[model samples]
Target: MAALEAEIARRPGHNIKRAEQALMTAKAAVLREFELTVPQYAGMVVLSYLPGTSGAQLARICAVTPQTMATVLSNLEAKGLVTRTPSSVHQKVFVTKLTRAGNALIKRADVKAHAVEDRLVAEFSDDERRLLADLLERAIKVLNG
Candidate 1:
């Protein structure tokens, strides 16, 4: 085999993009009963854990368009999962947080998320998983830079 083919074969069976797709699919399957998109579910979970968050902050954290965040906020609001409190001083700024329902949703999602995560990294040892994550993070920083 060519050197490149040999190198490719030495790499993990599932590439990053394929693994991401599997993760999204797993999460979607888990969230199907909740009638939520992945973005909405993730946004709500973030809000639940981080109080006094803003829509702009959420957009950054979730790495999505502000327009997408707006749509997610709307959906979450409709589902009674998230709430936005207007700033008394700055009318343009809103503080976002998760409701009781949102917290509950995250708790449920966490179970399924863990299962998915375990399955995804099953082939790798704990140290390998950590090393893989660190390498991926470094690559992401370099790409973003």
Candidate 2:
């Protein structure tokens, strides 16, 4: 623990990366119980909020390459959780939506995911959580810019 703290103190990015890894590990564990990968889970969550989104849009939103998103969508389609249809507005575009099965699975998965989140934040006050979120967002914005 002391060595880890010392290393992270020397490189702050290590702290952020480690935190992200831990969060992803926890999420993956919960998601696995539902037979979903992290990307698939993320895609479904996005679809729940924005139904009929384009594959390109989902790829951007999920921070994955278009090819990776295509594979994720294909896997979800094979699992009968989502469907992709040719867009009426764009002949070459395919829009994706969560099927009823996807909706139900996500609803259940969210409960488990939220439990992991709640456990992660259990030691923090509400204000601290907000501050952490803001700082993370700012770091992302700076890195992106």
Candidate 3:
């Protein structure tokens, strides 16, 4: 562990490069199955988390601004993949739902991404996965704060 950490300290670019590679790999796989960019795919994944989740909530979850979420929603809706309705929870708020096509797309993306995700974290145990996720969440908070 110490040796690896020392090496990583000297070659710090590996961290960012690996992250980018993973993103690119996932993007390529998704593109093969659906016509969505990385950000659009991210929005779709966020939408899948809760079918009726508000766009503003999704924007926060996906670390994007509301306007970017709106654009992504526009593209997804145009493709007949999602539906937006005036929220009963709030008069002016719109809740987004994945349409049949959107559900199907998310499922397909899951299958396509499995290999890449597995490769990325194959070394982690269940506990390690949890810790890694927690640490990354913390880092995101620190960086974005």
Candidate 4:
């Protein structure tokens, strides 16, 4: 029990988790003003960048299951933020794009979302930021391996 406690205290992953929670909480609060959840915001961002992307592709890019992305897309559609058209090539697939309102909302929300990331790295120098990113990638690779 003592060893486990000591290991937990020494682990940096806990700090990473705490930081993630803080970042998400801050973004969620700001996004709520625009009637967006984190996943919805993510979907809008991807759609804005890659218009006509299929839901399955968006699901892969957003790292959510197809079912979850479908729910998010449904909600966005209901809000008139996006439109999904049946694909010409694939009957089962639908291509998604932002409505004008969605584009505008995503643009507005992007400012707020980026602010959170800006605030997160506000204290770091350019070199330090790059180093931190590299270190995180290395850590992720090691863990995944």
Candidate 5:
């Protein structure tokens, strides 16, 4: 504990990266069963709720680059999990929607993802959980600024 604290003191934001790596690793392990990467799962979850979302919008929501989102969408399309078409309102914009398979997969995968979230907060009280979430969001806002 002393060594970890010393390291964290020496390198601010190290713990954030460590936490992110740990969370992503655990998430990847569970999502592997569903044949989904974290970004792919994220994109699908958004599409499940907001079908016909433009790719640019999805990229921004997912916090991924447009190129990365494009690849994710392509992979999902190849898997028959999603479809992309020219937007009705904007002919040049490509919108994405989950297919039946994508919807079903996200339903199944969401349970596993929630399990990871539950495990992450298992030791925290509800208030603590909320506080932690709020703190992370605040950090993101500050960093974005």
Candidate 6:
């Protein structure tokens, strides 16, 4: 245990990755109740927020490859949670939108997800939460660059 703690203290990236993995695990467990995977739930959430989004755009937003997004979109479609219609501007492009059922499912899932998030940051003040978000975003931007 001390060794693990020492390693974590020495590597911020490793610590962040471990935290992310733990969060994903907890989220997966919550999503399981709705028969959804983490990727599926993320796709649904994005679709709910941005109706008529393209699969490619969704892939970027979800930080998954286009091929992976295709699979996730397929699963969501099979579950009747989303629909894809050919874009009016581009016949070759397909636009995705959540169905009423998808919207409902995401709403419930959001509640559960928020509960998990709240618990994770329960000790932090509002300012601390905002600061953490800003710092994470800056790190992501640097890494992406």
Give the top-scoring candidate (lDDT).
4
| Candidate 3 overall lDDT versus native | 0.81
- The lDDT-based order of candidates, best leading, equals 4, 6, 2, 5, 1, 3
lDDT of 5 at 37: 98
Residue-level lDDT tens digits of model 2 in 20-49: 889889999999999988889989999999
Error of 6 at 37 (Å): 0.7
lDDT of 1 by residue, 1-145 (tens): 6998878756754476667787899888877877877888778778867877888899999989989998899888888888889977689888988888888887887777667767879989999999999999887998789
Per-prediction TM-score: 0.83, 0.90, 0.73, 0.90, 0.90, 0.90
Candidate 6 per-residue lDDT, tens place, 1-114, comes to: 999889777997987998899999999999999999999999999998899999999999999999999999999999999999999999889999999999999999989987
Looking at model 5, the pairs that clash are: none
Where in model 3 is the C-alpha error above 4 Å?
A: 1-14, 123-131
Q: Rate the local accuracy (lDDT) of all candidates.
A: 0.82, 0.93, 0.81, 0.95, 0.92, 0.93
Question: What CA RMSD would you report for each candidate?
Answer: 3.6, 2.2, 4.8, 2.0, 2.3, 2.0
Estimate candidate 6's RMSD in Å: 2.0
**Which parts of model 6 are misplaced by more than 4 Å?**
1-9
lDDT tens digits, residue span 76-142, model 3: 8999989999988789899899998988998787666666778778878999999989987887788
Clashing pairs in 6: none
Worst-scoring 10-residue span by lDDT in model 4: 9-18
Candidate 1 clashes between residue pairs 3 or more apart in a chain or in different chains: none
Greater-TM-score candidate between 3 and 6? 6
